[model samples]
Target: MVRRIGLTGGIGSGKSTVAGLLVAQGAVLVDTDAIARSIAQAGGIAMPALEAAFGRSVIAADGGLDRAAMRQIVFADADAKRRLESVLHPLIGTETQRQAAAAGEDAVVVFDVPLLVESGRWRAIVDRVLVVDATEATQRKRVVARSGWTPEAVDAVIAQQAPRRLRRAAADAVIFNESMTLAELETEVRGLWKQWAAATTR
Candidate 1:
């Protein structure tokens, strides 16, 4: 049987970096965010529903989602966010499950979910939850430097996510990423990868 692990963290927590390392070491990564993006792309499965819900304004000239416009609207209106999720979640969920199922019986599959704790749906499916954690200050600084997002904007996103303490409490394993070098982070991930591999084989 494949051991399914839920890998999650807040923005700038280096979750994607950890996921990359695991993939290099043979873990099958089911990235929900990527799936969501694909499903909202030009002529994607979710585009028709999004068009019906928000109209053509939210769809770009290329027929893909106008993500920036939609982001602005959704952030300003809670109802809009819910509406968008309703359109995309079922499709994303179905694709994620299909990808996991295709990873083969002996693989170690990692579901990289940005909102694992907030969603409250992944815990039942994953054998373990690995949170890549960093300090709030670190997260803010990293986001500002990498994305050029205003500090206030970053804070608003953090506010919308589950608190750090709550994520820690929910984690079955955690990688503290603050102040860690890339090499150190890779080493930590490698250790965890070994553990999961052993568990799956047993």
Candidate 2:
């Protein structure tokens, strides 16, 4: 049996970096972001559905989904977000499950989900949920720097998510991403990887 590890975190918490480390060690990396992008790509499995729901303006001139335009609309309207998720979530879920099932029996699989805690659907499927955590200040700074979002925009998004304390309480394993050096981070990841490998292989 392959072990499905759920990697989750708030924006800017470094969950993606940890997922990369897991990938480096040979875990099959299944990221929702990539899946979402694929679904939105022109002529993709989900593009027709998206175009039907959101209208053609959301599609770029080249025919691919205009993610930036969709993001702006979704962020501004909760209903828009819900509708978009309704269309994409099932498709993403189906694809993710299919890929996980197809991973070799000895595979160590990791699902990098940005909203795993908020979604509440993964708990039944994942063997373990690993959360990468950082302080609010750290998150704000990092997000603002990376996305060019204002502090207010960052806070608004954070406010819509499950609180850090709540997520930490629900986590089976937690990685503190507040301020460790890269080398230290890799060492921690390596230790966790070996432990996961041993547990799953047995």
lDDT of 2 by residue, 1-202 (tens): 3388889898888888999988887789889989989878878888888899999989998788997798788889999999999999999999888888788767888999888989988888788889999998999999999989999888877887789998898788899999988888898888888776656656
TM-scores of all predicted structures: 0.95, 0.91
lDDT of 1 by residue, 29-103 (tens): 999999999999998999999999999899898999998899888889999999999999999999998998899
TM-score of 2: 0.91
List ranges where model 1 is wrong by over 4 Å.
Answer: 199-202
Overall local distance difference test of candidate 1? 0.91
Quote the positional error of residue 146 for candidate 1 in Å.
1.7
Q: How much is the lDDT of residue 198 in candidate 2?
A: 53
Task: Give each prediction's root-mean-square deviation over alpha carbons.
Answer: 1.5, 1.9
